[model samples]
Target: MNTPTKRRGCFRNGCLALVLLPLLIFAGLFWAHRSSQALPDRFVLVVPLSGGIDEVRNESSSLPFLPSHESLSLQELLFVLNHAVADERVREVLLDIRGIHTSPAKIAELRDAVEKVRKGGKKVTAFLRSAEDADYLLATACNSIIAERGGFLLLDGLKVESLFYTSPLGKLGVQVQAAQWKKYKSGIEPFVRTGASKEYLEQINALLDEFYDDYLGYVSKRRGMSRSSFEALINNDPLVSAKKAQTLGLVDGIASFWELQRQLTRKVSGKELARDNDVFVSGARYRSAVAWPQKGESDERIAVITMSGMIVHSAGEMGEGIDIEMLKNSLDAALEDKAVKALVVRIDSPGGDALASADMLQMLDSAAVKKPLVVSMSGVAASGGYMAALAGKTIFAQPLTITGSIGVYALKPNISGLAEKIGLGRDVVTRGQYADASTPFKPLEGQAYNKFVGASGEIYDDFVGKVAASRKMSIAAVDSVAGGRVWTGSRAMKAGLVDRMGGLFDAIHAAQQLAKMDMGKKLQIILYPEQKSWFESLLQGRSASLSDRFAAAVKQQVLHELLPQRQLTSMATFYEMLLTSGQLQMLAVMPSDIIID
Candidate 1:
């Protein structure tokens, strides 16, 4: 028989073993997973392009072990493609396109990257399943385009739809009194009229024509066909079957995903793949396994600041829109840093508050005076977005970018009828004549209306003045292009509003040249207003509170249940416009909301 002390020691040892066993197993598995991340000596890198591609990666999950559903960023994808160009282990790039959604400008950038990979002696193939026009455009850049059997290719032509809220708002006893700078300042039309005005339709049609021509021209030239022939093919069969697409020379071949994989294996390794894991590496895995090349041995740095979304005065805790305060802080930091030699500002906004835009323009102008500055316009940069770009020594935009709506407007809502309908009453007492002028219970009239109009006109004049000074044009010349007219990037370049037709990398190269840095040498690129992790944002109280989240959820549910999708979207747009303008503030927003599909 064992002694009591021996028995106690045995029990303690058993408990310790139980706890340590799981820990040891977990550690072993972690190491195994890490080791498995290594790339095969010769493998095809599968890059999945799906959903919305953001400009920067956002960390959604706080825990490393948890799965993340975040969309991949263009920068991340470009980085991967650039690295693959040099990595000998990467035999080829297989782009798996599945309902990819992004701007045409981004698609163009990606297409260029694909061509670069091919030039680097690596074959790039695109695999499509139920692809659309944008998806097909990107695939055209690949060496060969393969589609799944029974898949459909939707190549419908482009059309823009503008929503009007005047009738519905009138039904609800709400009237929006608006003042616009000129005829083309049609941002107010949607709220004031039932349909698009002549000027709006004219500009929109021109944009569509340009986009259609460019799309047809690129696809035709790439596929070694005449533009007229390609256009006719699209017109005849807007939605063609994968087999039909192959017959029309749109795709190279049709095969099942498994068959494609087998073919790729044979092409790369000269034999069919015995195991999937041994021959193929995912883009995510490759990103983690391979290290990015180090920058050249230099102390110089180039700071890249992205001003996206609406230009707001401040983002506060919500972190929505392009916060001017955050941007100013980043600019100040870059200006103070001795290592930072140049700055490239990437803007993708549809404009917002006039004052905020002016502040941004001023800040950028000051920075430009101190150092080399270049502006890169993404997707839509109009109105106040254009205002901000005036500070750049040289501005760059893609051929399809929507820009230039240089005007201002002011709107005030009169809800007295609604209050009456809802049986609400209020009695106001004020010493000043205009103290109650901003109250929604009363419509702005007489002196109040005059004051609002005067302020808006002044803002508009200031906008034109800034443009004239920046573009080296006469005030009259700038005013001619002003009046809230939107222009495609190519048109903007022709109008002297943009200096170059290029993308983000082109702007960076221009900055490097201006800074007198080596053209071939790599420099440290620092992104402004660095993205924060979800946990970090929460710790800093930037994430929404529980109450706010609940309120937003309830509001969304109520709207979805009450209104049709189209009407709800229009209402939401109107609400956002109101929020952006605030009370008695002039707005330099786009003439109309535009989304290219």
Candidate 2:
């Protein structure tokens, strides 16, 4: 009620208002800045080939909107290299080879792609911290090859070793009960027996020998070294010292990345860069100072379908990447598209979802009859990977392509004895005599055991029959290689399973050939996961930083893992590994082999 108290209250209210007003203003400025950040206009492409194909994410999904300068996808790498050869602004290519991992098939593609750049009157230089034999396969294509100071280049003979785990399973009381349908179907060998089977070893040895020969031949061609000399170098791989590597003529020079950069910018217009990352915004959206030449859209209108990652059973929401239902929808849409002249199903999958593969193949068969359906395989196309290719009018594979595994096996853990050891037993009552047929909780009865084996036999039979008809081989010939088998792309070609040994562009050309198109005019092709547009970016907030993004991704991944699913599986991790050529991948798959949707 006093005048002094009222004045004090008024003073407090004004100060509080002052503090809140500035807070609101700062928040608005931050949002506005993110939305209207200066448009990036220059790009320096640094191609560091990383793992597999990654889909474009929304701004929140991928942040800072940096045009990808770090690691380029196989396709993107080719495009940039192609552009550099002719474009004046794309002066030089700085390729880093520290973490590049790829199969032999992929190695060939990169080598050829870079070689084309050199042929086009462009300068290409490669800087590697440490170079392996495989790394050299790619770097050899570059005009100038530089290795870090004390960085060793050990381009030696290639080795492919198969891992066998029969003894481990035996110690753990694991029983691998199943069939051997093909002479080389050694996928199950690691589970049941120690070391490679005589049948499996024979095929592996033959294939490894072929791959080694091809590798040495390629190095010899690029390095201009004699075959005898190259053989001697390979036998003495893992050079004792970096200085020695240069002395032996295995490397052009040994210097750090900084020295390499100093040499690169010697005649450039702008300031010399200190680091590789600063040279080009890694994983950032490219906005060139000179207008980015708009990617020419396909006018010829050829259909393209993408098969990505390990093909596993389609049950949950299309997890992380590839999904069966998502693919099914794409297939249906492509089949219905009128403008698509023919379909090119690009398969980079290691193979998953046995039933799904069959279903997808059927869709391809339908599309092929209507128009040319060509298959373009990258890196890998094995087991289910090969199965999907069967749907093509013609299949294109890289020479080092990983393919073939034309067989099937069904396995379920029988832990009944484990339960007994734990003083627990499962009892079941069923109206049907064989209702408990697949109860892994209990031991298999004589009659139930017979039924399980018989069922697996029927499924394997169905698989072989399809292979015989698709490859146009006799039942006998097909059987010779159809049991839970595996084969490299080169071997698959000789076996008459794959149509040709080539790349994606080759597959596109094959499509043109199949349709009898003119060679002089460039062809238009339709590809899946259509590139994102700038319009989408303008509407959303700027992409977040890496730390913020990683936190969000972890949250989403955790929720998906803990959620309920309507499917069954046995050993989710093992299935994924089988698909990815022994690369360990873990999935929370159900306990039985079934697809819910």
TM-score of every model versus the real structure: 0.86, 0.78
Query: Which residue pairs clash within candidate 1?
Result: none
User: After superposition, which runs of candidate 2 have C-alpha atoms over 4 Å from their true positions?
Assistant: 1-44, 50-61, 65-71, 270-294, 315-321, 443-445, 515-525, 529-572, 575-597
Per-residue alpha-carbon lDDT of candidate 1 for residues 1-597, written as tens digits (9 for 90 to 100): 976765565367678798678668656755766786777899999999976666665343222233334445777687788889988999999999887766667787788789889999999999998998878888899999998888989988667777788998888877788889978988888778999999989998898888788789889989989998888877887999999989988999999999998888888888876865477888877866765322445778888888877777877513456778888888999999999899999887788878999999999999999999999998778999999999999999999888998999888877777788899989888998889998777789898899888889999999999999999999999998888898989999999999999888789889999999977777777777665433344345547884454345445445544552321121244366564544555778887654434
Candidate 1 ranges with C-alpha deviation above 4 Å: 1-37, 58-63, 270-276, 289-294, 317-319, 532-574, 577-585
Deviation (Å) of 285 in candidate 1: 3.4
Weakest 10 consecutive residues, lDDT, candidate 1?
564-573
Query: What total of clashing residue pairs does each candidate reach?
Result: 0, 18
Mind giving the per-residue lDDT tens digits that candidate 2 earns over 175-233? 44544444455555555667666776666566567667877787777777887788887
- The lDDT of each candidate is 0.80, 0.60
Angstrom error at residue 361, model 2: 0.7
